[model samples]
Target chain A: MNPIPMEQSLMVAAMLFSLGLIGLLVRRNVIFMLISIEIMLNAAGLAFVVAGSHWQAADGQVMFLFIITMAAAEVAIGLALVLRLQSDLPTLDVDAMDQLKGGDDA
Target chain B: MFWLTSIVAIVATLLAISRLNATHALLYLIVSFLSVAVLFLQLGAPFVAAIEVIVYAGAIMVLFVFVIMLLNLGPHAVEGERQLLPPHAWIGPGLLAAVLLLELLMPLSNNQFIPTTGTAKHADHSTIPTIPTEAAPQLQERMVVGPKEVGIKLFSTYLLAVELAGFLLLAGLVGAFHIGREEPRTSAKPGAMEVPSQEGPA
Candidate 1:
């Protein structure tokens, strides 16, 4: 069996990032977009772990642990804000979020 | 081949996301995640493969299925709209698969194909052979850590991060509960009762 190389890890990470980016761009649902963002974060974490493994240091994994923490914090705050927005507008259509467009404030 | 499995996984994932019915979508998603876990296992990252199964296929999909059951959406959600749209959803995966096939076939550039070139100075001496395959079997064996090493690494070096991850997960549960708040509509009052739609706030 061939030992996995860092390049292969990078390729997997690239696939994940591309999929996530496409989802974020194409999907209309904010929740679905949030899931895509989580996927992207996971791709980054995987790359970090792979790099760390080659170096024989656990530092990269430690950093990924922190990255996961940040992602959790972000989604918590983000979803809360989304809840407030939904409560007021009662529509999750991100396009309508243009209400924050100059038209509403003006 | 591994490429075949990867392609299948990608196709499954794309189908999972694009399906109109929520339940079918979740089902396809489970297939996709499981296949990706297999890909990870083939990559020799058994640890990541386990996480992919446990965290994604097991926990996250359970959450999705729970939400689907809670919603109790009407049967055959796409029953009425049979005509207007062309069969476009199928095309998306076809196009993606084509691109993936191209990527799989393409050869790597110098940066990717270049060897690591380890064991330089000792390579000259007869002690270390130029070709690794010609070397001693004892030296060629890879180092593998048992569960003990993993435990030590997790608790000793990563204790703080592990504790923090637990706290983050707790907070996520609370946040999900709060954000996913549905009106406790135990009893429907009347016709004008406002049931929330997906169009509800961002």
Candidate 2:
């Protein structure tokens, strides 16, 4: 059996990335947006591993490890922010938090 | 075979991103991650595949579910979410996917997509004095990465990176702790009445 071509794996990564980008743009809920970001990050990690395996080098895997670590840290901060927002705001909707847009005195 | 698994993962992700309910979206994302893990295995990175499953699908997904539960977005919120998913939601993603698909397909169209030549080394070594049945087994072994290689390379070449990652994790822990802590009630209200600390709410 022929080894799967590197192009094929890269194509899958692109598709995943695109889907994630769309999700990030379309999802209004802050939590859903975070999930989209995670998807995009994972897709990037997949690309690294695929490239590394294609070239027979361990560097891709090392980068992937770093990506995972980065992702974990990101999610921790993101979710913490979400929790804080939920507590301080009346609603979790992104539009509702537009108070930062310079308000007219109430 | 790889195509099949990847397609499944992509479709699951599509379903996930389109869903209005946050929990439902997360579940589909988990499905997407699992299939991607399989794709990683097929691509000859078993260690990364395991991490994909354990960290991405298991631990991370569980954390998302926990947050969803804690937020308690009820049925009314679900209704609002549905309204938020307008028809235009598909437009942005579709356009982006189209552009990316074109870029990815270009290499294949030009016949520039070369299979990794490194496989030749493994093939050469495995072909010597191996029985026909044993050939498949040896090839399979060549495809997988051992944890030992990953560990040695990680500690030796990427040692400083590993240290930085640990430091990053510590920072995340501290940040999460600080952000998630409850705020103390202010005691400076002039006209407000204060109840005893042991007393329950009236």
Q: Which regions of candidate 1 are displaced past 4 Å?
A: A56-92, A97-106, B1-5, B14-25, B72-147, B181-202
| Ten residues in sequence with the least summed lDDT for candidate 1 chain B | B110-119
Model 2 chain A — which ten-residue stretch has the worst lDDT?
A97-106
Tens digits of lDDT, candidate 2, B45-145: 66777788899988888788777666664445566566545566555445434443453355335432212122223433422223345244535544545
lDDT of 2 by residue, A64-93 (tens): 989999998899888877766665553567
Where does model 2 exceed 4 Å of error?
Answer: A100-106, B73-142, B186-202
- What lDDT does the true structure give each of the candidates? 0.52, 0.70
Clashing pairs in 1: A86-B201, A90-B200, A91-B199, A91-B200, A92-B199, A92-B200
Per-candidate TM-score against the hidden true structure: 0.59, 0.73
Docking outcome class, model 2: acceptable
Fraction of true contacts reproduced, model 1?
Answer: 0.08
Most accurate candidate by lDDT: 2
